[model samples]
Target: MSSNSPSSPLRVLVVIASSRPGRLAPAVAEWFVETTRRETERERMVVDVVDLGALALPFLDELEHPSTGVYAHEHTRAWSRRVADADAFVVVTPEYNYGMPAVLKNALDYLYEEWAWKPVAFVSYGNTSAGTRSVQMTKQVVTTLRMMPIGATVALRIGDSIEDGRVSERPMLGRAARQVVVELARVARALRPLHLAPATDGTTPGPVDGLSLSRVGEGDDVSELLVLQRSCWVEEAHANDTLDLAPLHETLADVQAWAKTWTVWAVRRHGRLVGAVRARAVGSTWEIGRLMVAPDQAGNGIGSWLLAVAEQHAPEEATTVALFTGKRSRRNIALYERAGFHLTAAPTTPDDAVLLTKSVAATTLA
Candidate 1:
C-alpha cells in the first residue's frame, strides 16, 4: 500500500462506531463508502471500511499510558497500525443519550499519536437532532488528539432518511457524502506538516509528524530498535547470501552494551520507533554503523536523511565518516555513493562485508 503522505494516495478509514446487534451503523457507513467510491478512485483516494462490531475490541486493558506507545497486546498494536496508516477518517455513528457511543470513545482513547494530524468527518443518524450532538461530542475528543474535524458532515434522521436499517438512496444525500470526502482530502493535505515532530533543538521539523528523537535507552527503545535492525537487514542478508550478519544475530544485551558507548539515536514516528543509527569516533574517523529504516518506509529518503543526521553528531576531532555493508548489497552501496561515500579498501572489515568512507568536509559541504 502507498503511504498516506501529501504526495501519495490518501487512505480514508471509514469507522463504523456502533457494535450493537442489528445496528444501522454499518448501513450508514456502506452508504458513505458507496456514494464516494467512484469519485474517490478518480482522485486517488482509498476508502477502507472498519466496523467496530466485527473488530470486537474489548474495553481498554493496557497498563501504560497511550501516549507512551508501548502496547502489551497484539490487539492494541494492530489497532495502532490501522489508525497510523490512515490519512483521514469518516465515522458512521448514532447518538446515544445526547453523546457519542462509549465504544467509539474507548477506541479513540486506546491510541494517541496515530490519530494526530488527520482530519475526521462524520455521518450521523438518530432521531430528532439527526445525531448532530454525537458529532459535536466527538469533535471535542478528536480535537484533543490534535485531529482536525472538518465542517462537512452528514446528519440523518432515521424516520426521514433510513429505510429497513439502510440509508435511503437520495441524490442530495449522496452529494453530501461525497462532499465530506472532498473536504477531508483537502484538509489532510493542508495539515500534513503537523505530522512532523519539530527538531529537539527547534532548528527543523521531522520528516513526518510525531517524531521523537533521543539517545537510545531502556524502556522498549532498545528492543524496538533491535527488531527494526533485524527486519531491515533481511534484504541485505539475501543480497549477501549469508545469515551470519551481526544485525540479525545480535542479542538484546549486545544492543544495550553498544548503546552505552556509541552515540545512538532512535527516531519514533507517532510513538513507534521506525528508524535508528549509531556513531562513534574511531580515532580520526567516525565509525557510523547500524543505520536502519523500516522496510515499509524505505526509498522515501529517510535513510539518507538519517545518515546526514548521524554525520552531524560526529565528534569535532573526526575527519572522516565510515560505514560498512555486505559486498553484494547494491542498493545500500548506491545510497551511500549518492550520499558521497566511496568504497575503500579495508582488510579489517568482516569476511563478506565492504567498507565505505567520505571526508567530513565533503559530507558537511554537501
Candidate 2:
C-alpha cells in the first residue's frame, strides 16, 4: 500500500470484476487504464488495476462482522489494506443472469469500513443492456457501504465493443473511458471529507468540521505518518533556526520502530493526513511526543485536541504528562501552556529544547 500526502498523487483503484478463465474483463480494464493514463498523470493521480481473478478472495468466512474491522484470515487483511489505502474505485463489471457476478458480490461482502465514503465508477461490458443491469444491481450494495457512485459510466455491448475477445479501438469509447477517470477524480476529491470524518460510534469530533481522529493502522498509515511528521517539522526548524530537529530528520524506519512503543493517533480532514500525536506510559507518567499539525492547518486547536487525547490515554497510575519542543518554538510553547502545561526545570533537558509537564488528576478524562 502507498501513502498519500496532500500534495501527492491521488490513488484510484480500477477493479476488474470477473474471475473466469480467458475473460474479457482484463482487456476492458487494460483499455480503460491506457485511455486514462495521460489524464491521470496530468491531474497528479495514479491508476491501479485490481483483477478479482488475481485476488482470488474466498466467500465471506469471517465469523465477526466486517464493521468491526477484525479479520480472521490473512487474505481478508490484505484485501482490507488494499481497499482502505485507495481514495476512489472504478469497478469493471460484466452482466451475469441479468445482474452482477457472484465473485464481485462476494468481494464486496468481505469488508465494510474499507468501502465507506469513497467514490466508485462503473465500466461494464456485456451482450445486452451494455451490462448496465449489473451496475444497477451493485449500486444499492455500494450505497449500503456508504459509497457514493458517480453519474459518469462506461457501458459496452459485447457485439459492438469487442473484437476477437478484446475491446475494439473505438474513438468514442476511449474518450468515454477517459471521461470516467475525470469524473471519478472530481467526485472523489469532493467526497473526501466524508471519508476522513471520524466514525459515529462515540468517537470524538475534532475541532475542525471534517477532521477525524483515529488510531493509526500499521501498514497503510506508517508511511503517511512519516511524511506528515517531516512536512510539519519544517516550520519548526525554520522557527527555531536550527537543522537539528528530530522530527525533520527521522527516517521511515525510525517512525515504524517508534510506533511499536507508542499509541499513535492520526488526524485527517478530507482524506488528507494533517496532524498526529503519540503517547505512552513511562512508569507513572504519560510521556507524550511528536505532536504535529500541518503548517497550513495550524492555529485551529488540533494540537491541543490531540494533546488532550493523549493525556486521556494515560494509565491510572500516571500522575503527569511530559513533552519537549524547540526552545524557540514560542507558538507551541504557548499552546502547551494554555493546556495547563508548565515549563519543567529538569537538569538533563537539552540546551536548545524546553521541557513541559502537566499534572494529571485521577478523575481527568479526555
* TM-score of each predicted structure versus truth: 0.59, 0.58
List pairs with backbone clashes in candidate 1: 195-209, 196-208, 196-209
Q: Which stretches of candidate 2 lie over 4 Å from their true place?
A: 1-4, 197-366
The Cα local distance difference test for each model comes to: 0.79, 0.79
lDDT for 342 in candidate 2 is 73
Show where candidate 1 strays beyond 4 Å: 1-5, 196-366
